[model samples]
Target: MKMFLSHLDSPLGTMLLVTDDRQVVRALDFADHKAHLHRGLREHYGEVVLAEILPPVGIVGALVRYFAGELEALNELPTQTAGSDLQRRVWGALRRIPAGSTTTYGKLAKELGFDDPRAAIDIGAANGANPVAIIVPCHRVIGSNGDLKGYAWGLHRKRWLLEHEKAMKPAKEEGRTAMLPGF
Candidate 1:
């Protein structure tokens, strides 16, 4: 299968977006992680054939809107990734995490039906292997103590994304407040 590739310039840094012929996003990672991206693609799909094209406008637009404070813009974009059943389940749960909220690995593991704390290590590994970055929302996972933890894109970018989402959260609430009958 031929993989379509494109570059997106984001606030944190440049990102490489990979999609299939049908335009379902397969991977999105920082441009600096080219080697990591290639390794992941090779592992997931042996012998990837890459072709460059303009980024999918709808997906890129959604990301742009997300960075511009419209956090829900990313909610509707389509994605496709190759992974184990556990990894796919973990990634799906990651998307359900609210934009401004963080969940610990233990919490996520429990949510996925794992009651033991050791399950968190497996959960963390799945999070680390998430193919799509911001769209999958893996950055929202943190340590049990609420410390920012591992993010494939780097902790600095993780901090920035969380802060950006948090800052936008108030604006959403304020908008709701303004529409209420009483000030």
Candidate 2:
């Protein structure tokens, strides 16, 4: 398996891109070094894909396009993601969250037809486990209190993603738009 990292210019600052020979495995908010990010990759991919070698810049380019709102669906880039069946369900649900929109965990739980918040919390855990970042749009899920919470990358990046999507979403009517808690 091939592995590499690249610097991406984004509204959230420089981000790290990690990929295997087939598809992207991880995209992280910038860190001083790659060592801190290797544990997860090592656990997920074994020794096949190591972080010592940074991935090609093109991998990062795709992410840049995504964050810029130039690319809508992210099935183009290859991603080798592993998760439980329930987690997969949650991830799939997350993809349907529209651009410039936010959904509460409780609401998502209801949409999933579960009356309990624990089920939604399970989905949230899976969302947090997601290796492919912005593409899956896990950042779209927020606390029922309307606060951003529990982003593996960091809360700042989560806030940035939400604001970025809000900025990208087209205006619906004149002088009137959906307002978010922090945006």
Candidate 3:
């Protein structure tokens, strides 16, 4: 399949967006990880061609809204990932994680019905291998001890994402509910 490539300037850094012919996002990663992004594409699609062009405006708008502090804006963007069954399952679980919350690798493993240490490690690997970044939400997984762990994009960006979501949650909640009892 031919991959369309585009670049977006974000507060965190420059991001590369790759879309399939149908315009579904195939991968979104930091520009600094270009090599890894290409490697992932090669691994998944095998002998694919990449063409530079403008990405879908709606997707770009969603990202802009997200970085502008509308945390839920990212949830609506469509993404397509290529991976094994376990990887796909883990990626789906990652998306289900709420914007302001987090889960440990071990906890994620448990949620997936895995209890062994090896299973947790496998989950972590899948998380690291995630093709799409923020939309897939792999950054929300932390260490069991609550420390920030491996993020393919970089730990600093992971911290920023968690903090951004944390700061936005209260405002989001306030807009959704009434503080007082029946008025």
Candidate 4:
């Protein structure tokens, strides 16, 4: 598979954006998560040949606006991801998680029609397997107890993204809604 790879500047860090011939986003990840990104690409599209080039203008604009605090900026952006039936369903559900809000793994599993308690494990795994980062909104998922969980990118990045989306209060504020950094 052939794709265009471009680097875009964000407040958190440089982000890698991959787009297809139609300019639809194929994948996106932080520059720091290069390995995760590559693994995702290889799984979704075997033998990907990435060419250094600019991403779609509309996609870049949306990300710019998203980082600038416009939470709805990504709502209309188009993306295509390849995964199994359940994985695809889980990824689609992740997108429905509102930007300034969050859902728990167990809760997400239940919402997806899974009554078994262990479904949270599957949900968590699917969330980890998500190829698209912010656009898919996987960062909005938290533990059932409302504690932060592992992010493929890192816990810090997840917390930062939640704070950026106002889903969680900043680490500095002393409030029940806030999570202290390094905790």
Single out the weakest 10-residue window by summed lDDT for candidate 1: 174-183
Choose 3 or 4, whichever is better by lDDT.
4
**Taking the tens digit of each residue's C-alpha lDDT, what string does model 2 give over 133-163?**
7777788899887777798877766766776
Candidate 1 displacement at residue 57 in angstroms? 0.9
Q: Per-residue alpha-carbon lDDT of model 1 for 3-70, expressed as tens digits?
A: 99999998877899999988889999989899999999998999999999999889889999998999
Per-model TM values vs. the true structure = 0.90, 0.71, 0.89, 0.92
RMSD values, in order shown: 7.4, 5.7, 8.0, 3.2
lDDT of 4 by residue, 30-109 (tens): 89889989988998899999999976789988988998899999989988999988889999999898889999999999
Error of 3 at 40 (Å): 0.5
Error of 1 at 139 (Å): 0.3
- Ranking of predictions according to lDDT: 4, 1, 3, 2
- TM-score between candidate 1 and the true structure: 0.90
The residue-level lDDT of candidate 1 at 2 comes to: 82
Model 3: lDDT of residue 164:
80
For candidate 4, list the clashing residue pairs, or say none: none
- Please rank every candidate by TM-score, starting with the best: 4, 1, 3, 2
Q: Tell me how far the alpha carbon of residue 35 in candidate 3 is from the true structure, in angstroms, after superposition.
A: 0.3
Quantify all predictions' global Cα lDDT against the true fold.
0.88, 0.66, 0.87, 0.88
Local accuracy of candidate 3 as per-residue lDDT tens digits, 67-140: 88898898898888889999999999999998888999999999999978779899999999999999999999
